[model samples]
Target: MPEPPRPEQPSDDKVLRGLVGAGPSQLSTHAALRARDASQPTDEDLAEAERDLVLVRRRYVPTQNLPPGIKPAN
Candidate 1:
């Protein structure tokens, strides 16, 4: 049997430019987000976030509560 066709990939130069060609403002925003993510969260903050997530998961929202055009999973 014949193999399926593969999608065309971007050239290395194109990929390189895409990563390196961001404007100063975009680069600064990216750097700030990276710095924030690199910082470790405190134990108290982690605990509170975990508690909040548990509460959110425990609260049942019926399918009817979902916005229009959004279907529930099978």
Candidate 2:
């Protein structure tokens, strides 16, 4: 049998929006993975992480995308 085509991944903006909407615990884990791991992430991982951070900051509070701030105006 032929293999099925893989589904497309969500765009970075969409992913980050979901992450920001996910709230604190999720954000903490994401921050920890990106921050605690001193080892360099691959180009893709690094880019994703950077995008996550930027989106999180903008969408949430100034204090590490925690809460109590305005999300993107969409």
Candidate 3:
């Protein structure tokens, strides 16, 4: 039998809003869920999400848009 699928990530709308309006917590949670081994997402999909998360980190990791000391519990 084939391996199980990965979990579902948040929708693009939520992702965009979370990335733009909210902090990195939402994005990190979505990433963790997508990384799970049950949703059967393709490698390409995972790669794309990884790229998006990297870009997000680049945008916030330095300037630290998050509230002071409020780290995404990822």
Candidate 4:
């Protein structure tokens, strides 16, 4: 008599996520999860992002040099 066919194995994405106790909709694949973890912002990356937001004035004028009517504090 012929033997019955075996059940299909789950994909690597499903198997790996299941092993890590992650929900089904969390990540698509193990490699993608690893990549995301590895690509987290470092201290340098944070500093660079902050630096990008800073506005550097090309020319500086002292408060004493301002016009009489204009108040720099206000």
Model 1: residues with Cα > 4 Å off, grouped in runs: 1-22, 25-34, 54-74
- Tens-place lDDT per residue, model 3, 1-74, is 99899887878887667656854655576675774645687999889887655443533455556555556545
Q: Give per-residue lDDT, candidate 3, residue 11.
A: 87
Best TM-score among the predictions, by candidate number: 4
Cα lDDT over the full model 4: 0.67
Error of 1 at 23 (Å): 2.0
Better of 2 and 3 by lDDT: 3
lDDT of 4 by residue, 1-74 (tens): 89899898988877556657645555557866787789899999999998665343445546445545544442
What local lDDT does model 4 show for residue 68?
55
Q: What lDDT would each prediction earn against the true structure? A: 0.63, 0.62, 0.64, 0.67
Ranking by lDDT: 4, 3, 1, 2
Q: Candidate 1, TM-score vs. the true structure?
A: 0.25
- State residue 45's C-alpha deviation in candidate 4, in Å: 0.5
Question: Runs in model 4 with CA error above 4 Å?
Answer: 1-28, 54-74
Model 1: per-residue Cα lDDT over 1-74, one tens digit each: 99998988978776446547775433357865675687779899899897664333344566546656644444
